[model samples]
Target: MEPRQTKLIIFTAKLIAFLCFAYLTLAFFPQYAHHLLLVIALALVVIGAGSLLKYKSQRNWIESEAKLLSSEEQEEEIAVSQYSKLKYYYPVIEYAYSANGISYTGHTLSHEKENLWVPEVNHWGDPTPATDRWWLWFEPGDHIPVYINPQDHSEAVLVKDMTKARRSHHLALLTGGILIGLIWLTLVVLNYTLPLR
Candidate 1:
């Protein structure tokens, strides 16, 4: 599926989940809302923490000197329907670097674009590999900064600024988790003190 389609599906699913939870708490199971909310809040907090920790681990890879060996634009076609087709564009890049006297070849730019998708549309508002935004970043035989694992030289990433977006995403998750937890706690307190009975 296209990236936009996948994002839409995920957003729709989250909205539906929130609506169902709200209905249950407000109308059908008011007495159990506190407990349910607590569970949901805890789940979000745990997921957020896990994401933050994973991002931190990735951030530990030290910067290294690497040179782009080759860069190629690749395309794949997907049949959206009998009458329409979608074309996705991506850059295939190979780079070489040395760490600890061992030379390593890496093809990974970043995990963010591993599954990036671009639909065949004239006006795409979202970030898509089809645009020059990504291709313009690097060229064949260009020297690029890379991050490599000190212990394992073979593991490396070619995209230097990829961590900025990743950090923001994890920070958002942590913030969302804290907000949800606080909201749930407030609801629990109000349930006990307001004397709705």
Candidate 2:
């Protein structure tokens, strides 16, 4: 199957599974459903804030050039649940760079954790050789622009996480809206479930 089709299938399966789980949870635990929604809202807010902070930190990294030593495509199997697993492909890049006369070997394409596995956060697409062939853009010994941590020369990335930079703010706002909506729903549920004085 085509990479895009496969990604769509996987995403659909995940969405269906999540919806089923949410339905079952709310059905079986009506009293605790609000608590579950609150937890999910808080988790989204925390994740969005964390991604924003990482993006801000990456903005301060100094730009440098690194010699590509080697690059390889690797696959990782992520288990979404006990019954299901999804396979994701990513590039393992090895490069050498020097900062402040100290040489370092780095092995990260981008600093964002999601960048390593998910190509797009909004769509939750799978990283495949056909979809994310970033390694194919360079050959051995090629000099590539990299961002290096000034204080820690060992920390480096071949690309600035533009996804994080572009999406973090939107994610924060989205999560905030979800949180407020969930809070309002929780209040309504409580009011309906509680006895009037």
Candidate 3:
């Protein structure tokens, strides 16, 4: 099995174990369930807000010109089961920039996670041909816009805020917080307004 498959299996197992434990706890200690959910909702809200704030701060980073050093595609195949497998393709970009009279090299394509897989071939109704990979967009020695951290010259990225990936990530975090908050509020209102059995 692929390492990715192992990691996914471990994560799924951990999540399932956690959910089972939570269910068992709530089943035995029903009185504390409300408080547990409220705490979880508040923690999610805080985490979501902090993530958005961190992303927002990246927008203030200064832009600098960078020379493309290399661009290539990384391919990985993960076996889903005995007769099924999934292939993922992502771009690997390397660029160099100068800041504060110092030169630095960066390999990040965006403020988001390092490994971002593009849509699979013919997936999601994508019209782009499989032959056209993201790495084909640039070549060595080409000039590209790079955002540099003013406080830390070593940190930089080729893409930043408002990209589809970034937007979706933030939106998901925000939605999680909102949905949990609503559930918490509704439960609180019901606990107070509705007659207890």
Candidate 4:
């Protein structure tokens, strides 16, 4: 999987999660609280959109000027990611395997419903194994090995993890999550604090 695809998967998940959250709020909240929740949801949608626009503009500027920028500056970004120990990767390994004391045995598979990564060796459309392991499946191919940062095991991901526009995608999704959480909390607070109830 490429960075671009990983970002798409992550962003899609964020969008779906927010929509579900909104639906749940609308179904349960009273009129006043529902109003607040709706406003918050809209705000998140707008803010996330605005961020995309800004990112695209900057990307365009970079693309047009990328030729002029020093090669060092142009390539410095990925080399300076959150993980530094990933100096070398063993691309020969396949099959997503995790040795979190229990040695999770599973292949990386996409969760169509959740739109995110799952540790289950099973494909989507199944339940009871709603458990989470650490491997992120990218593309369709069993046991695709991915290099991990030994320092922080949680930061490990398969080759498909970098998705195109990684920074922008992560920023937008994180903002969306924060916004949804804020909206959810606000609705709960208003529901309990307001005297109208």
Please provide TM-scores, in order, for all candidate models, with all chains considered together.
0.51, 0.58, 0.68, 0.25
Each model's Cα RMSD: 7.5, 8.6, 4.8, 18.3
Candidate 1 — worst ten consecutive residues by lDDT sum? 114-123
lDDT of 2 by residue, 51-74 (tens): 667767888899988999998776
> Residue 85, candidate 1: how far off, in angstroms?
15
Pick out the ten consecutive residues of candidate 3 with the lowest summed lDDT. 112-121
How well is each residue in 127-191 modelled by candidate 3, as lDDT tens digits? Answer: 55665565677889999999998889999977666556556666677778778778767877787
Candidate 4 lDDT for residue 120: 23
Misplaced by over 4 Å in model 1 are 1-36, 46-60, 73-90, 114-134, 137-141, 160-169, 189-197
- By lDDT, highest first, what's the ranking? 3, 2, 1, 4
**Of the candidates shown, which would achieve the greatest lDDT relative to the real structure?**
3
Candidate 4 lDDT tens digits, 52-105 = 553343322211000111101001112335663112111111233344442332
Scored by CA lDDT, what does every candidate get? 0.69, 0.71, 0.73, 0.41
Q: Which residue pairs does candidate 1 place in steric collision?
A: none
Candidate closer to the true structure by TM-score (higher is better), 3 or 4: 3
lDDT by residue for model 1 over 102-160, one digit each (tens)? 88899887655523434445445454443544654677678888998766778887653
**Which segments of candidate 3 are over 4 A away from where they belong?**
1-24, 43-48, 75-88, 113-117, 121-126, 129-134, 165-169, 192-197
